[model samples]
Target: MRHVLLSLGILLILTVSSLTAQVPRRSFLFKDARGELAQARARGEMDVLLVIASMPDQNEQVAQAIAGLGGTVQFQADEVDYIRARVPVDGVEELVSHSAVHSVDISITGSRAFGMAADAPVLPNSEDFSASGILSEAVNPDTIIWPPVLSDYPITNRYSPLFDIRASEFLDSNPTYDGRGVKIAMIDMNPDPLLPELQVATDLDGQPIRKIGVYGTAQDLEEEDDGRWIRMEDMVTAADGQFTYGDNTYVAPKDGTFRIALFHEARDSLATFGGSLENDVNRDGNPEGSSRLFGVLWDEETDDVWVDTNQDLSFADQTALTDYNDRPEFGVFGTDDPDTPIRESVAFGIQIAQEKKLIALNLGSASHATLVVGAALANRGSEGRFDGVAPGAQLISIAEGGSAYGQIESPLISIRDHGAEVVYFEQSSNITRNYLLRDGRLVPTVIYERLIDRYDPVILSPTHNYPILGGIDDFVMARGLIGINGHESKENFFINHGVRVEHDDNLLITGGYGPMGNGALKPDVISPSNYVSTALGFIEGRA
Candidate 1:
């Protein structure tokens, strides 16, 4: 009797709701724009706008109209029928009034999507377990937790088991899908090529994965130093002419020849001195040398350390690293400018190695790139433990110019030409909180959609790290884009009942919200990110 009354009441409400339904009303704004673009007119401001044309023929007319409004076309993609330009915010309505303009959206300003928390440290393991492959149970090393904490330093290529990527389980289920032979392109700031984790000795199929192509300045490693900076005061010589500092022992080159590098802190974060290890120390203009170990040689004259910048084995001919002011014409401290300023802190690192190098050069600026790439394809670490999501995929690195805008087109084209099956670009518009323009369009979304239709590569983008904003980043708002959100894991430190405990799985507070402004479900998936212990190629300030 109660159920019947409820059903009758629900039917009555539904019939009344249907009878009183409101008619759909047309929007007051232009078909091509959102309210924000329209509101810009009242403020008399300027903004970067991505204008898409209805037809290819009107591209020229659109360009002319932009020029007439004292606007400059920053990027023109005639092939795609779009142009990105900076026009007066007040003049947006005039530009939209043109018959050929199909849609007007906000342009993106790029920001690296990576960040690091210095307060939380990932420590090394107490023992090296016997493990050698991606499928091995001991792949992620067991960390030490006694004596309060063992060491704060992160281990290179040490993938944390707590931040489970489920690669082993997924591989076990399929057995054949390890991204073998797939070309995965990464476009970020410079990544260290010689990092052992990035290199492949032998993959799961007994094949060696390799970089098919590398774009941008041919990876001028010669200009880049090879090792991390070691403070001069920390160098202590052992009986065998080996250098020992803290827990690190650096063996000298077996052949007695060494290339010493002295780096001074500089004003603009540029190294005071750096040169390719490939320099012909024999003065033969050839790349053959018998140096194995890099050692620090104290200079008596300048009371400062010196580098063999002149390629002579002897340190006599080199000037004091502090004498950059006198060598203005000679490109001091790796800078072509004559006026590079030096800071008080001076550090040095070994640049040449006959066998295996010691500490790898840590590009602190490139940490973001390292994190993203490590999450994707870092091979098993030196211990033969730990593996990335797809350790068998062939890598192609496309470095981008350091700018917020107007630099990614070349990299995109390069990746497309290389036949990349997966493309991961480590950039997001964190500053521009707007995920969907009022008209429900993101510039990257449109561009990526066209690229997907033409080339067919899986694109992965991050839901920006602001959950309060309640939407994914602009790039991930559209179809065919995988928006990844961050989730917490057991590895992250937390306090529970007056004791430190590893937190369980939960959506990271740093993660963005879903169900986008247009009512579309966003953040296609979530991944562990609170603290992922992966490959950190270089050790910084170890002494």
Candidate 2:
């Protein structure tokens, strides 16, 4: 329910600064505003807010003044003394005259830009097909019975989202208006060849249905991993005594010792990246029963170094609870006290949590834009559950990996040169920011929102993020009903966070069900999904 994003060095507390001090516009301070205003005007938007930056101590007074001036504040960055608010269109000049104002510009936006840089150093390269999440192997295709024949929930496959919008109906009704002649353009890093269903159809506009193009963006502008996750690759391969482990003690040997590099044997295995301690190296569903983070112990007699799977300084001992205390005389094992939970200790539990947190802060999960395109355009083969709308239509894909101006402009060059009718985007957010190069330095910036003309396919999933919340629920689902370790149930079931308790008898319970905003559009639409396992054939390896 609370923000899971934990930052270490961020101290955003209020601090005083001189009222006369001027804060120069920095790229990180604000989004590209001038360009955004131009887009809003071109798109016919009215009463758009201008994000304002003020002197450190002037934020409060400026906010009150803005409120008095009929402007509603959307966000306030206390550490930076910035305010994003919707000011009156008629009083822009007058509001700019406010003494506390340092800079006034349109509110900018940021996006994941679809994963890491093009030459991403990580193993899951940007071009990896599976990273697209589009061409994933379907677990259930045939003989997997789906949704029961309920009264109101009749057959929905092959005729749901498309039929509701009459695309499929038109396809079945008449070929006259079919997308035979249309030249649709799509951009992605990797695209599956036109599916079998579209193999025969030709476009009426003399354009091929399988048209493809490439757009050039910055190769590796992404500075860090932003996936908010931790994987095996993120772990340190080598161990140093100078570095501290989770127990606040040095991981280093007495003074001159070093632990041999730790390596994840399952680096190439599917379904890894659960951070270290929380990772199920053995895949036994006993994640907390043991830890995967190992230290290297030198086998003096064998003349070899062995991986200490547990943080304990022993060789050839299993990391599981079963063999956790086998080498007690080495002082590396716990007291084997039945009363104390081994997982509760820092070396075993808290340290892993800290490592995982640090890892989540550094990972950059792959983008699924091409994946979305695959779900939207990929035609069904023998593995039938549902077919994308207008399977006969042509497609063009380009990988826009960066948010630079050249990167943003490169696609339009391809679109214009190729003569495209439809464009597909899966960058997650609608708005993207651009840095304005001024004088010689990159200063103020503005973000641009994609404008939907009559032709572009603007598909979106209707889901509000509760990422951490969902992870908690998922953990409970896998482990069973979590018992209350320290609090009440009616209101805050997730109070203790992820501390799990063992119990029998399966039961599903909802937490944070307190009334907030009761009504919202339910049943989000996922163009491509891996829900065949959960919802049967209704969403089988579907996209």
Candidate 3:
């Protein structure tokens, strides 16, 4: 209660401030901004998050000056006292020199690192289904009981001592309090609202619960090359009685370290691009094989290409080819033997772009968001497996992109426009490597601090999966944020699926430890993360 009742709302801001109260306030000097300013100057212009002191006309004058210098105020949080702006590099020094500006740092809009796993496997839901309804192997579909008993999932029930949260008994006692009137906003990647497991029922008031409301504009959606496709006929050339591989313009890797390779549309197997003696790799065995398909592949590891020009299905006979800057096409062979062209494509690009495409198609973040929603409020009705912790809570999906500012902005919009009472963000605000956030004067830190004071919604975020002293970012270190730590369950500990299981409570090995530089614990709470069964998106199955 000591941390509650802030500003206009009543909220419990869980933080380890009591443990860090005695730490001295660190000071920032002009020299601290030198490195960042130099980088901004090199870029010509940059987006900056400025922590400004609450002064009379000073904040407005700073904004005016920034605008006059070819910059725009992107966002402003008066309560936490911060301003986000895109300022020209020539004027960044002038902007930072303002008396009202407390601290200056770059807004990491370009940072792509996220806490959510991008490659989480999409499991088949066939096993969890039956003609009668969706039921797990744990339950007897013939018997069909209502409000399933705890003994069903012998490994770890979705409730008490086994899962360690005790939601079963709590729901049994507080029937009306099972997230009845709450709106939980899942701020993560794209989540399909049509999934059966993620479907919404009704609220406590018996009003038909709306479908999971998807919010936000995906920044990458417009830039995505969804129309980039090559027909197989255009890729194959018939010369010398053998069909040879053609070429396409190469899309260079954004970073010099990587190059992507496009694959042929037809393949004999999923294991490798090459075919066997029994099968035609390029499907060129038939008259219509010329019209197959081709795709783009960019390998971030290497840029060299190796073609099996001899058609023996072995790269050992040939040498690696370079000079991609001059020629983008390679006349690969072995359309006759096993699908050697596919293998050559992989070797040529050094990685499978099609496999990367498959990963993107799977949409791990979407599946992850589905799991998060199901874990909170999945109720199968007569189709019984296990109910979520809050089976009656309303759900919303706020899809976000790579922008750091968009991350916070999405949740704020959810709370304001969609009436979200609880926001579960899948990404961490870890800008420690991008910019130093000393003394909690960073823009994200200030914005989070003020957001809680103004709205007082329950903001939940997972701590970065690192064990360093400052593993938790400075923004999450704000006074009122709830940082969550994922731990291993008894089932996961026994399964021993490569997890180190090395913590006081057998938590995750990569769980971030506490007592940051400011002496505050990184995570305010720990919860079970392993062995969770939830819905998958982009695929018609659940694991």
Candidate 4:
């Protein structure tokens, strides 16, 4: 019996050892890294390359693999393992299975490759060979910048000069609206306690303004300073349940001409960074507020604006203030404000333009219908909105609006019917594909070309697929009818397409996509969209 037990114990020990040994420890390498990379790019997947080598023999195998893969090889002594080519999706598993491969890592190539600031570490095993799991540790401008502001106005001195020239020429003979005394409505997640340095307060006649009322839940006022606290109170009383004042009066600053009645809805109670005001404020133990800005009432009173602000501003009052054929109105659309239905918001804008008799309307909205409707209203004027490129020009959007082509067509048709002077369409390639279908073609139709020839409508479509820039930037550039690529980063590609570094801005072979002027010198110049800090929403106690 003792002898049998001893034999069983030995067998158990052997089984355990074999199990550990069977766990693959060595990394493998692929001979053709470039081929794999190309394959991944073709498939539109993230590229991952695995290298398996020890400190002693880094050069020989790494060099051979890179050369074999038809790619340039650079070596760092600090990196002891084998160097592997980063190939996109399909080829990753095949590369991992290669006899020479030890482990795989990802590297982005193409135009974004030169600009990448950091490198990824090598994975220890095939099980950890998840291209999707790999995350970029690098910080991007968008990451550092919050509350993106649209400062790329063609007339602005800071950014593009060509656009500035065009704007000056257009506004020279035209009557200036000045947005003075114009009541502009803005729906935001929260109000910035600090009024922006660039905040304009002029009335239509170019007067100054003061005392902008802001309203939110009672909890929204916690920790707010004295000024913000008073503002919040006034705002709530003006819009909240069953509250009425004879006439909501506001004092405009000398340079400020308009009174802004801002309304916010506390969707949740959470105080963290997002959601309704009813949710926890800190997401810690503290209770806080979450609210979203719904809509703004410009110079008119429409049922939509009234419903959003819960005020009796009325369309007639708006019409009395401004003439649609004489003044210009502008709209700025935000990508994050999903709560507000873009269609209703845009319809409200059209109504405001019609009532106010404004010369031009500049609107920004998220959904496709908003862009379409906004364009239609802008086209209503005889002299058009601006009398320049968009002469009688009206609607300008950041992108073509939603993902579907049908949605885009709705706005396009609206622009045509309304006799829009010009309209700018901005979108990423992926967004465009979603709109233009896989097999669809975008040949220039006669009417479309005629509009382009007459109005010079600019479409800023980044062939590179990514969300580096927000929708507002697109609209600003489009309005000026200036074509330019804004921000380019390898991380954006990784975030959008799994294939790392396969294609980049540099890949625009015809200089149409490169640093220099690409696509008929369309992107006339570059503007800064980095580290920009702007007001997000109003915090109760914060200013």
Candidate 5:
């Protein structure tokens, strides 16, 4: 009897509910709300109105309008207001004609007046709403605790590693030259201070290797000189024929040959001294002898260092020297001249190398103007172009957009006039956009080719998919140095370029990614670049 009664009651309730179901529920309709917003915006009734409703339905109309106006809608809410939208404000009348709005208000975005009028506050948290709070609380614990991982791998080929050395049978005979004392001038937008490996080499005892002079932007020229220069000369004479290194002891060559290192600020001083190595001999009236400037050293502690000697020192002898400047410059381009200051630095560097009678000059900063001028003159016609493949054997660099070809050539000519035999133009810049008319044939101007022919320059053009890094194609073409950055792609490029392309053993290359894998090309030589930390100025860091 109870079961029958319950069944009858359930049937009666169902019938009543079915009849009542004919009436719609009194809930907010999304379409209706959206229509209302459209009408308000169309009527120009809202100054800063944002529709904060569900996606798909609520945002559909607004999105359409924004799209038609050539504006983009970002999904992220954190920075919605900060984003500027270029909209057709002139079409306000057509927008106000839409009908689904209940009210419209006009006010500045984020203004108290706008918020108060809308019965809300500026910068309202989405969590402030009950519905949003409930959703937040209902999130799955696992989703919150362990968010999906985002890849953080560094982009491949952010930098190029290079190996450099002088052309000596002893150094060239070996498969790998350790770059023990070869000075490499690095011209870049900025150099980091933490890169210790980029600086002078240490003695076998692992102490910081000091040089004769350290130069760059931050260094202050010394007002006083210790007897170090005199002592070094004395030691050189005492050693009879060979150079020796000891605690605070640098021996000059016994044959009246003196080696001194110059860099950044020191380059300026050397140029000012007319390319002569300045050292008080016998506390005499003036410094004497045209010291042979050989190499350029760049490091985090010291911006730049140049080394030179009077006698033809072997590569090993030059490598054994260290920077001894108390106040070392600390940047790539250093000068007080506001206009063309950096260019002046390069000019000064070249002048000093010339005066010192260096066999090879390592210059930082490559100016396209210099290369272009050389090319234009060599080709004789605007349509024809030429370039240098190690023009005069001086290493030059082009880093960043500030590079100017016109500004850099005079210095290059100066270096060439000196004993510099091979010049490497590293770094690329803007080339002529026009097509070259050659024998009535319209050909794209080969900027690099022209430059090479003009300067008779040796060029290193690395074409890696990675930005700011060189690729394998660059290494395959030449017998000179190779620079590799840390990246599997770049490492592979370096390896292939070194092993398969150039069989020369004296190749010097540096950077992270030491040899790994079956076909990996072990670095024939390595020097600090990316891994070596160094101080950087604001612009340098950006570069």
Candidate 6:
């Protein structure tokens, strides 16, 4: 009964999304879009409209129009007020010229453009030893709690969040709240339910906290015998390195137990760094080096640690570790219960969000997806650490997961339909910088003249440039990485967008492929784009 009521509530809020075309032809068509239109006609297809809706029912109304014209809708969003759809070539002009639409965009999504040339990604090996020292980082080696809370810092990822890691003053206030009735939904790949990190105790109020739903939107996709998406393994590889899926079940290190914690490797150490998997990212300089037996391998059962100096990945080539993995030994870890996907992995991401207090959704692979959400649930910690914000918050992962607004809608629905008080999603698209092609060039335009804004109390990660946190994504996307590109460290700290008030020689930010309107300086606040992130594990064989 509770589940049914919650589901219905979610359906009710979806009314905020309309289902027909109030197409404003001019808003949908590009300036002098003749060439593209002709090309579409020649190919018997048209470029998809990433529609920016202006009202509650507007999205649905416009979608109805597109379907009315026999077009296929790729994605929809009431959260950000937009839809990705492929309209009939012949109906392009008429559709865009319609009066009901506010804005439309032609994707710079091609081989030579902002999009990828191939589906398969070409990236650095993510194997533990691929990048030598970037394989792992020590986690809570001493079992010392970040905020001295036994329950706060217990995630098994090598890089877990500390008490005040979320921000400088985060610990000043009491977590007086435990997300008692709050529900959170992660719209990303499937999470391993078996991960000890995901185990949720009943709310402090004594109300049971467990999954109330599991909605899979990608029902058309094939699945493995375990119900994982047939493409789950491949899509994850497409995400990068040796990642893990299903549930993360890292063994909890007993008090006084030491462990070498490191995630897999990527080309840049920024993507993978912790413990003795040294990339010069030690919290206090010097990395506590291998001779100290701080190199990077942990034998949980034996309480053994090894350092890989030769990088051969064998204990023989390494030094036996007693060095405490050179990491803070703060968190708790335990074997996660055995986890199996209830459905395909991609679809399971959102579903799993429903049952836990927090979830880490990694969307680092899709440029399109990452443009808005890069490893969302990216909880960055101070002093080179990471953890989910609001650790005790309940997670509701029964929604579907994928790119586009449809992926977002599920979680939003979870909020409306369930007890999810907060949803920690990154973003669905970096559509803020979306432009209209005009006079052979792209013109910066705001087509969202008619949509409503979602002011959900969402804990957003500067993770993506999407509007998940309402204005944050637009602000960051407008001026992402002011100084450093993706991987530029400063003072031994991993920085993502390189803005430390002029630290590490990072002084420039990208801007202006098009002109602006209303003349508001974008990126309202440029706090700090640090690389202190919690890892989302989906390793190849960890399952």
Top of the candidates by TM-score = 3
Query: 3 or 5, which is superior by TM-score?
Result: 3
Q: For model 6, where is the 10-residue window of minimal lDDT?
A: 343-352
Candidate 3, 394-502: lDDT as tens digits: 7755555435555656676677666788887776343443333334555445555556767888887665534544465555676677878777665455553545445
Q: What TM-score do all the candidates reach, one by one?
A: 0.52, 0.30, 0.55, 0.28, 0.23, 0.44
Q: RMSD of each candidate?
A: 17.3, 23.7, 16.4, 26.6, 30.4, 17.4
Tell me how far the alpha carbon of residue 435 in candidate 2 is from the true structure, in angstroms, after superposition.
13
The runs of at least 3 residues in candidate 3 whose Cα sits more than 4 Å from the true structure, single-residue gaps closed, are: 1-37, 43-62, 75-83, 109-162, 218-365, 381-385, 428-430, 433-438, 465-470, 492-504, 540-543
Model 4 / residue 242 / CA error / Å: 10
Given candidate 6, what's the lDDT at residue 505? 28
lDDT of 6 by residue, 392-439 (tens): 455554323322333334454455455455554433333222322221
The local distance difference test score of model 4 is 0.29
Prediction 1 TM-score vs. true: 0.52
Better of 1 and 4 by lDDT: 1
After superposing candidate 1, which stretches have Cα over 4 Å from the reference? 1-61, 64-74, 85-93, 104-165, 170-176, 201-206, 217-365, 381-385, 399-411, 435-439, 467-471, 491-503, 531-543
lDDT of 2 by residue, 144-216 (tens): 5542232222123322334334366676677545455544544333232222332333457544443222212
**lDDT (Cα atoms) of all candidates against the true structure:** 0.46, 0.34, 0.48, 0.29, 0.27, 0.34
Best-to-worst lDDT order: 3, 1, 6, 2, 4, 5
User: lDDT tens string, model 1, 1-543?
Assistant: 999999999999998875333212112223224544544455565664443432334677888888888887865666545666777775666776677665455432233122222255766453444444235454453553322322333344343432367666767788557566777777664444434456653445657745323323111122223233333433333345454433445543222333343432221223211222223211223334533223344432333434543323434444433221122111111212222221111122222221322222222224455556666776653532345676667665544433323223533554455677788756534423543442234444445555665677887766664546564566665456677777755444441123354556667654566666566666777876644423323223210
| Candidate 6 wrong stretches, greater than 4 Å | 1-26, 31-40, 46-86, 106-173, 178-180, 201-208, 211-387, 396-518, 526-543
